[model samples]
Target: MSTFQTPQYTIVELLNKAQCGELQLPDFQRPYRWDDERIRSLLVTILRGHPMGVIMTLKTGGHNVRFKPRPITGIGHEGLKEPELLLLDGQQRTTSMVQALTGDGVVDTEDARHHKLRRRYFVDVVKALGDVREQEDAVVSLPDSGIVTGNIGRDVVLDVTTEEKQHAAGLMPATVLFDSARCFAWMMGYQQGAPERMAVTQQFLSTVAQSVQTYKVPAIELDKDISKDAVATVFEKVNTGGLRLDVFELLTATFAGDGAYFKETGEDFRLAEDWARTEEVLHKHPVLKEMRSTDFLMAVSVLITLSKRRTALAAGKTGKQVPQTSARREDILSMSLDDYRTWAPQLRDALPRVARHLRDLHIHESRGIPYSSQVVSLMIVTTLLGERAEEHAVRARLNQWFWCGVLGELYGSTITTQLAKDAEQLPDWSLAKSSTTPEAIIRASFAESRLGSLRSRQSAAYKGVYALIMAQQTPVKDWMLDQKLDFQSYDELQVDIHHVFPKKWCEDNAIEYWRRESIINKTPLAKKTNIRLRGDSPAVYIDRLDAKGLSAEQVDAQIATHAIDPAFLRAGDFDGYFQDRRRRLVDLIESAMGKSVVRDWNVDSESTDAPANFNEPAASTGGVSIGGEPTPDRTL
Candidate 1:
């Protein structure tokens, strides 16, 4: 069946329906924003009998698509009920027409600067009758008071406040154009007062006023059987000048229109209020704040799909007859309120658990999260597992899948597909219900050369390596503060990623730029500790630490916690330190991914062709260097 029908309605019919509450705007439609000039131009277009554009609407009685209905702005008829048709597009144009052409001719609109204005429209009958081309200039907008003033209201330039004054000034109120009785009465008054201009007034009434009364606006009425997603999609396509409505906005209107929910609960369902409360809960856990409303809705969709699949299987449906689990956009759009109710609390509870799991991996904050997208899958899989997610063996498997996704960079794109797969597979795989490895783990691969290009903390792999280093069997510690790199100290000490081998020292020694800036050469350190490094060589820094009353052995032990070779750092051997640390990092990644990394020992030599600057002067700064820029002592 065709989804819509193109029907034409006269301007009189559209306005009458709107005033009587038969035609209304959907809640998803944005408020009217047409300025005074635009409204005047629209009046001119109607007077000229020109095609403004098509208006799109949806039949409102359907069980499938329901949006809360609101009267067009400036409409205040008592007991306004549910509309028969919900205006989807042409809201601005239709609203401007309704306000200007009906209900006392007063329009609540804005000026060019978006200043609020209450205005009444009029047609200068003299100018309108003069020339056909001058019809547009005939429309005029005045303040609601129907008086024009100059010099800050001290001078009254024009006053059409009464019917006699309007007739004398040759101004025809636009509000009377749609009402034949009012239009005829205004014409009789104008003709009786000025017998000499009777021919011009009759011509103006027969032409401009007649055109407005008979104007036919094209409308596309969507069938009541169309789906909610289709309505949202169609609204977006037609309303291109407006903001695009997302799934949450669509659901907000859908839930608000749910009469069944209102019957049961005796109150409206507000998705935004619920989300705001959920957001408050999320803010309590810093890492979980990364989960957005869309992500939460996607998780709910996945659980609902999985629930349907389970029910179908239990009813003996098999193979092609069974529903496929999905978290795709279509599935999210089709999800019901009951489905959300069934899983929302569990998913909300599961996110905090996800945050705890991240903390266990030494990822204490949102910045440390490698892939925020991965959190949705984790929320779903963890919720499905429940208490078992806290079990040692199950957590180990879950950790492996997560690290594989991060190091492999698989969650950067096509995330919804991956989210569905992990939602369906990870729970079974982690709990030993199936022995097959998840695709994320199977497809995961880390090449040795990526480490050279992993220079910025922006890379997921770079952040992953940092977390893994701190999460090692022996916890990494601050070199100066000697505190374990756990969640408490991580924030309390203001730890940040800093260079292990000072950038200035590396540059002075003519090291390759890529090697000098690589993740392998950086580790998280306390702000105080980084400042004390003072752009000095590792050999010089260690001696300074030893002078602070720390034994060499204790200092070396702290360095070892970060997967570094203490002897190489103490000896200031850049080559040995770089090679040894790279291997150690690869080992940590391998353990986390539960897979072997492809080895490329020669990657350092082949990665870059930029020559070392052996002739550049070695500039010194009193403060530590960060990212190769020197800072003075006070600046630290």
Candidate 2:
């Protein structure tokens, strides 16, 4: 049965009473979460006579929650207490009306998170201040810094002439909903969200904010007598965020729904908050951002695992709850959250050849996991494989399937497993068949918007980098994979990408010419040497080939295969570097495609040049490298 409560009240009346501090929130709640335009808009909607929704609350008869209405306009949020009333939904709309009509307190809406993402339920002080009296030197002038905690991140003191209604409350859009003292209001006249493309008129909007103009469910009263888990079940089905509520959230709601202290701000919220901070870091990184949210989630999983805090989120009230701190926060919020960033340093110190081994998955796409999930799965797998392992490279791709399969088996994981299953359906011998390909991901990523717009989190340009990597690596794995020279395992392999002119060096000299992800900067080398010698120019790198027991000629020949410019290498820059490499890799890919045939080169075989008949380049030039012109495929 539905626990939804159906009730209605004037937003203006709620706001008027709330401003006088007649409303308060349950002790189990957190502070006001909604931001500026959101709260102001509620007032406008109510003034416009727009139909708002009803509010729902749980009935707790002295279990432990005691809340006195504060002079706060919107609902207040404090820690949870036992046997208290809990708001199940309609929080924003109701609180908004309370803030607007009440003179007791004002809601703060400064949208300061990350970068001014105006959270709903926040107040607009500039507008609210107009109703106050100007006792300060004729008129109160706000200082440069007047925003308080929980307010959007605006840097202005909101001192206003306490005489005008406009100054009394910030001008807000028409869609905000506020939870007020014993009342709430929003555009509830229509049912569900109207699809009129914000059809609310500008005139009405000037008065009532442009909020969702619909009258959906009013409210539902929750019986305290019922089990909290049952109440949680009702909430899980009722609250929004259409995507499934994360595992912990569901568990928390169900497990503690009836406790007066369980309504809000529990272990799950803390975990999500921590995850969000980490998500902030990953979104900024080139590698992590290239992966999907699932992949990012995996990274978080890996971090949590490595941190030995795996159970922190789901841990119920254990004294060792997840530590919330700014320093830990930096792990996710301030830096690049890439494999290179975390494992890079570790890999550099422990296994210099990490990049070569890492890219093996790209050569042959593995199925059964989404790329993001795989990344997480891979991190865990890699952790399981141990660090400083030079020979574990080949298993990199293999472990992806193994460990991920186990995760699926245990958690009933769907997304990652579905991705794996989906990859098998792709064309044969394609790069995506081995590991997830950038192209496959991109096409799938924006099956909706090819031009750009990866998501609200990452940018269009960033997605391009991932797409580019996939294009170069995955499409021609049969031919490309062979470049490693025929060994089942990455360690047994004779050749790997050797930066002929180390990228770090090239970057210094030819800053403008060096391609960010150039194919030329890469060449085949032995597993051992690539790690020992990093960022060396072609000449220096060739000289150091002995560390891997390779002769100078072989090293030079290996570098030649990539055909990067020696002059560019010498100058360390190639304005034409990327374009040239793009042409070469594309040409190579095309030649591989045309060949109805593919053969692995034996690195150890002391074979002479191919017979004249076999030396001819293969059949079709399948892909067009993004160079100035399309060149014919030339297979080595």
Q: Which stretches in model 1 have alpha-carbon errors above 4 Å?
A: 127-137, 168-170, 502-513, 534-536, 539-552, 570-573, 601-636
RMSD of each: 7.4, 17.9
Expressed as tens digits, the lDDT of each residue in 1-636 for candidate 1 is 799999999999998889888899877566788899999998888877789999998898898988888899879859776699988888888898888888788888889998999999998888776566788688999999999999998999999999999998888888887777788788888899568978976786787678777889999999988997787678668768777777787888888888989999998788888888778878988877655677778788889999898899999999988887877767887888888878988887787788789999988887678776677788889899998999999999999998999899777555677877897789999999998889989999997667766776756778888888888989899998789989888889999899989999988999887788888899989999999997888989989877777799999999999999899988989989998998999999999898899886573463332333212324434322111222222110
Q: What would you estimate as the lDDT of candidate 2?
A: 0.35
Kindly give the stretch of ten consecutive residues in candidate 2 with the minimal lDDT sum: 627-636
Q: How does each model score on TM-score?
A: 0.88, 0.35
Angstrom error of the Cα, residue 245, model 2: value is 7.6
**Model 2: per-residue Cα lDDT at residue 180:** 26
**TM-score of the candidate numbered 2?**
0.35
> All models: lDDT?
0.82, 0.35
Using lDDT as the measure, the top candidate is: 1
Candidate 2: where is the Cα deviation over 4 Å? 3-41, 54-85, 103-217, 220-269, 272-370, 380-414, 418-558, 561-636
